[model samples]
Target chain A: MTDEAFEQALINLTETMYRVCYAQLRQKADREDAVQEALKKAWEKRRLLRDESALKPWLVRILINECHNIQRKNRRVIPTEDVMPPPPPEDADGVMHDLILALPEKYRMPVLMIFMEGMNGTEVARALRIPPGTVHSRVHKARQILKSQWEEAQKE
Target chain B: MKQFPDDLSRAFGRADKEFVYQVQCTVKKLSEEKRKERTMNKKIPFGVVLFLAILLLAMGTAIALTIHNWKHIETAMDIAVENGAYWEWSLNAKIRLIEAMAEDGLAVSEGDMAALKGDDLTEDEKQELADRILTEQYGEEHFIYYYTIAVAEWGEPQTWTLEQRYWFFKTEREKGLYLDNSWIDLLPEETDLTRDEVVRIAREAVRSAYGMTDEEIESYAPNVSFFITDVCDTPRWMVEFYTQGEDGQIHGSPYSVLLTRDGEVTEDWENLGVLTPAQARLRQERQKETAVDVFTMRGQMRLQDQNTVFWNPEGGKHYHFLADCPMVNADKLPLKELPVWDAQFGLLTPCPCCVSLQDFWSLKDKLRYDVGSWKYPGPDWISEEEAVEKARAALEEEGCSPEGLYPAVYSTGALEEEDRYIVYFDALLTDPDGFTGVDPIYYAIVDACSGEVVSCGESESNG
Candidate 1:
């Protein structure tokens, strides 16, 4: 692809890329590092994209892999004391953000892609390399968890 | 189908401008790599390759000749150096080598090397020369020595296996040449402490110093290593323990102790002071900068209201802001939150160690409480208003404007043992709308009893 075309594609998908990356990695530094690494890898392997339509899913897959690599390396080292969960937000709107983040890793990404990134079920499956049925099931399960947490918070 | 809430969609808009800058930087770097690759693809002509080969060949030949000539001179000196020019040249080379080695902290005396010269030397003379060099260097009675001959092959030095010999020197009776130094045994197995004993001594020292229980000591599993220091003139064990400090950093503190063969501690152990005051201040500054960067990336102006102010109403003595503050016990979960008015009215003092509060209230006329003990005068100290005023004054002295900052005050109540109350306040920078800025939150601590400043500095958070 030409440099101008590549830059345009990147600018159009910046928000989607960031949401996907932030959903996987919590820390700001880790998110930035993962996105930069993913972009470089995508540029290096740009020739492999036979069709321009496949670019978004391919980039998302590379980014998810980079985030996983960072998480794996972090697990091997002794965690510093500052690696605590972000403090809970006090506002009503922020409750959903925290609940989605609190969801288990397996369900969090699919929920984020469908809801936050506005991707369809098939697109999420393609990006994650999973069956479309699996993506639907994960989204359903994540919503159930969020519903229960929301209900419990309301009762309190 | 359920969809993401509007708030959740808006949260995605919180992307930092720094991310875009980082992506552009990466693209620029990749483009530079592509340009370099294109330049490198150009082919080199055969004439250049042939010229480079010829140049390398000439350099190799010169190096080989130099090595060959040096080897011949050294061999002649070993056998018999009757020619005056050759003798003087060999002696000068030997002197230069010894001088260079001495400058590199490996001393070799000229007398020792001179004694080994001359091919007519007897075996006894050679043994005496080796003994003198070893004794001068190691201050030991016995030593193992070896010498090898190097032969030139294709401009490279290869070991001459047939001429290599080893010698062991102790007394005149034990002095003999062999094929290798392996024949000489140097292990002082009986005089050294066992590994298990060293570990036990190190563990005991750590436990006593830190007041740690047996379970806590076992879980930490301090690392112990053995080394021989001349101060002890024997092997001693160095023990290091990794502990979480008040500043939320894992610090390794090492202690060195000398132990006898019988596992008795012969000398008092000394703890290595790792972090100085300047180092602590530097670390705090770095952490504050990192926190500011993170806040800016997240587009957050300040911490949650209830999250920043922590209080234990039942204890009713102190108020804390930072979750990792050292004054609060690690096991104390779910710290209670208090309103700004209640926290200020109760006259609760802030922790000195965590908040870096200056002791504003001196306890000269008031009763003081001794830490870790209940043996002291009653808790009599300054009022809440006085503590707050003193803290504000301290921040003002540090060039903080009250009009542009929101002040959060916390305090530790009067302790009979300490003889004073400690007040701490965080001077958070805010715009006209009461929104916090990216600047560091200044903190000040004061002694409530005498209204004297105890300590003052900046923390990573508003606390």
Candidate 2:
């Protein structure tokens, strides 16, 4: 594709790519690194993109893969810590965001892809390379976990 | 948690202005990297290969045709040499001598030329046969083929074959079969000086005349022959040596030096004047244009002071205005200079300690400030109309008339390092004589912060 077209495509999906990276890699530096790495890979393999229509999904997949690679590398360096509980009521959205992050990795990925990245169940399935039914069940399980934690916090 | 707040978009929009700029820069870098990779991976096109093949075939055919048309005319027979021969003629010189003799009505044919062209006979033998043929037919004047030869062993008849030869004409402009006195060596009947003395004198003359070292003269193995000629009206020693020219071709020029009977060097022939003053100046200018800067492999930078700017050879990114900058290694004495404008164009910051101390402080400060302030536009910046207006004002300040002139303004975006927009203004100056063509007279880069022209220069082209 022409440089202008590739640039325009990146600009159009910048928000989606940013949200995916931010949701997976919480640190600002890590998020930026992931996005840059994904963009570089995409540029190197741009010739493999056959259809312009597939550009968004193709980019999202590369970004998600880059994020996972960074996470795997980070996991080896630091010991696993328990996921933090939801915060207080002054920041309700922040609380919900933390609770969603606290879910299992598989369910957390689908929830973030659906809510933050503005992707539907099938789109999330295509991006994650999983069955659409599996994505639906993961989103359901992720919400259940967040609800149980929210109710328990209310009692405390 | 009936509804997780859908403010994820707001959080996603937190990808700041800096992030966007960084992504753009990364994309630009990646694009350049890919372009380089593609260029490296590209193969020579088939059409270009085909064209080259056809061209070579055509050239080969032309050379073959020329060789086929070469006419064979005359030849001299091989001369026999005794067991102790000192000199012999080159094969090519023998052929040319025979051709010249045939042209002068000597009865030599293609068969004789063929017979002498064989490699079976020794060179001394060939020279004897050539001498006999010339003496019998055209007289001693026709014995024009002559060159100094070195025998491996004295007083021994070893088989010698001539591989390459040269044609010796009577004069540069004359084609007659004549060997000048300069080519022939007449052995001295009674010499006051020995061969070693004559050689020492010749070597000293060569060293003084040509500025060649003793080692270089020894490598040339100069051939010295003593002969008497009326040109100098005295006896002189002729010195000839093969020296490599600037073009990498070997050239041998004879230098004549007259010596008295006591071996005191008298007068030597002066060099023929070659390059005039104007030609020398032109050559110097050409060398300057093509010479590469030692600091940067690019063209030599010409400084504003008319001195070329050189950098430290010991390796530093900063270019120094002075060749002997303290930062430069003393052992690497001779630093290379580059064109000043090229250094500026390359965005190489000058060596602060070297350049700031000199009178070029203002120029250096201006370059550093202007280069640092220049920026590419981000997502939200100044409007194009504002950029154009600033550019127009900048051009007007540069003394361009707004009536006949038109300005082409380009917005290059905001500088990420500073809060300024980079706008380039190109003013098309209409010819005062009402000519059809538009000449770009002024190019200015203005900062959006203060609307001041950071850099301004005359444009080289209309666009």
| Predicted complex 2: CAPRI docking category | incorrect
| Residue lDDT tens for model 1, B1-463 | 2443443565444566787777777767766655543222223355543653464345444443433223332332332222211112233343343343444445566565665665666754664455445445433221111121111111111111101100111111122211121111111244666556666876786678657688866654344444332122233444444444333333333333444445665544322122232343343333332333211211121212233456655653445544444345556645666663441322344433222221221222112211111122235656656766776687677776444433334444333324333333333333554323223245556665678976554434411
lDDT of each: 0.48, 0.48
lDDT of 1 at B392: 69
Can you write out model 2's per-residue Cα lDDT over B141-181, one digit (the tens) per residue?
21221211111111011111111101111111122222132
**Shift in Å, residue B307, candidate 1:** 50
* Tens digits of per-residue lDDT for model 1, A9-55: 76667777777877777666677778877777677655333344556
True-vs-predicted CA distance for residue B178, candidate 1, Å: 70
Q: What tier of docking accuracy does candidate 1 attain?
A: incorrect
